[model samples]
Target: MTALDTSKVSIKTSLAACFGRNLYEQPGAHEFLQELSQSAQEVNIQQGGYIFKEGDPSDYVFIAISGAIMLERSSPKGARHVFAFLFTGNLLGLSEFTVYSFSAVALTGATVVKINKRLIQNIFERHPKIAKSFHDFTTHVLHYVLDQMYILGQKTAPQRLAHFLLDMDTRLGRSSGQFYLPMNRIDIADYLGMSLETTSRSFSNLKKRKLIEIESSHKIIINDRAAILEFIDE
Candidate 1:
């Protein structure tokens, strides 16, 4: 709930980055970004802190500026289902309903820009192009959810793990195929809908097959992406 004096410049930079160069380079995009920056309030969240809980009023939208964010939901019986791990430049807290359908939590010490949904709506009304861009962004998010559904509904345990690794590689990996995992095995298990033991076994299996190298619990290097892809195909 504590707000930081996040500079307008920083907000503009993060917004532009999240919107992508293609959109930012569009006519009037600079002014539109500035308006968004001016309306945004930045907040720093400690590790494991809740940004917004499920059922809270969907009054604001958040854009990640740094670190990782976990979007999840809990069953009445207290089981948790992780939806996604959002990194820098990802958007969250967007809901069509009056209340949030899921909770957003900081996976690490994170910074995020919070903008009132009403204010954004007003801005979007004025900037049709920006609104179109945002629509496209939401479409991408929908596709991501669909992909996760496919992974959970159809893939085997090892195939699910493979898809998860490839996804993290796409999101957080370097050209050298090394990436640092922000979430632990338990988080991975929850996100992939597998037991922690099964998730761990899948990682071990990949390591045994020389498809990936485990530098540490958090650091991973894909030794052979082709083989990993082949395994997933099999």
Candidate 2:
């Protein structure tokens, strides 16, 4: 097989290893996802694969099993704007309020459980808590998206990258003042809406400041996380 095919197979294996089954399928989390799991199915995507294109029909709401997905929009001019990174435990294509406004592409190989909207609707009708949980989750997502907008509109390139790193570190449940980055520089740039060169320079600047060290292509070791968080808090 070709190198690209080998890489896809490796990613698929890693994703399967990380998540043997959907976490939400368990008896918890208000049963919204669990009930839907009865009829749900999982699909795997190769790296750089498009899960759904823009203007596609919104049917199944996907729950990620492993890796990450990037939701982006492309203009006729060929410029691309990444909207957000959907990580494990995040849902994709759940636009109950209106039609989906973005397209999702796999950033890495990923596994997702596809849930029927009709099934989810029935569950919501029966259990009010499920609806409340979904509302809360979506609200949290909106707040993060708005925060990204603020970062994009107001923050400098360095600040934007710093804030993004800090936020991801916090979410990963790493120590309160410790962190790392799992994505590559280009992915980070796309997620932050900056050039790859800018992103690399920011990392160099951070390292020179003794704030962090690039542990590997897929990892960063945070040093003075306190100062980083302090700067981000401002």
Candidate 3:
């Protein structure tokens, strides 16, 4: 496998620049970021590599610096279920216990900064705003997970596909109305709780309806956002 910027350096070198150049809009976050990022170390994962497996001790949480990371779980029968694909600025390893409940794998070769979990408390003590940021982040993650559960239980195959497309559009596509889908059809089928053939058929139906267009099976273009929204089961 090809290397992807693997390094173990102090935050003062690279991440420090990321913090300063981002011009974080949050007031009073400068000191908090400094305090939290001090002991951070950067690690790179090549595509298809495992960052951490299920039952691994969650000593450190990760912040994606580049590429994509996929959170997944395997059933007793060894079927893989993808929960989420994390991108730059996304946090990983948020759990109620000391061990990670799911596995994190590199989808497209990712660079992530590993910060010890101990820093969470320090940040909360030093900067309440950053604590609020953590709260909001946790809430959004929970809501999205719950939304996926609901989709699995209540929505039809086509509806689920439409909802997933809208979600990608809102979070990743934004101004462009197009974005790269790192997960393949099988992964997406697992994520949406459907068969691979069902997932493919749904995509074909959407294209037939002129609601979306697929390019090279990875880059997607949403042609009719309003029409797609109508297909979402709510």
Best by lDDT: 1
Model 2, residue pairs in steric clash = none
> Cα deviation of 155 in candidate 2 (Å)?
1.4
* The 10-residue segment with the lowest total lDDT in model 3: 1-10
Model 3 shows how many backbone clashes?
0
Tell me which residue pairs clash in candidate 1.
none
Candidate 1 lDDT score relative to the true structure: 0.83
Best by TM-score: 1
**Across residues 1-234, which tens digit of lDDT does each residue of candidate 1 receive?**
444344456655667656654766777776665665566677899999999999999999998888899999999999999988998778887777899999999989999988899877886787787788888888888898898898799889988998889888988874468999999999999999999999999999888888888999889998678888898878
- Model 2 misplaced regions, further than 4 Å: 1-34, 97-99, 172-182
Which candidate order results from sorting by lDDT in descending order?
A: 1, 3, 2
Residue 102 Cα positional deviation in candidate 1, in Å, after optimal superposition: 1.1
> For model 3, which pairs clash?
none
lDDT of 2 by residue, 25-89 (tens): 42343354344335666688888887887887788677666767888887789777777776666
Q: Which is better, 1 or 3, measured by lDDT?
A: 1
Q: How far is candidate 3 from the true structure (C-alpha RMSD, Å)?
A: 4.8
Give candidate 3's error at residue 12 in angstroms: 13
Sort order, TM-score high to low: 1, 3, 2
Looking at candidate 1, what is the lDDT of residue 167?
Answer: 83
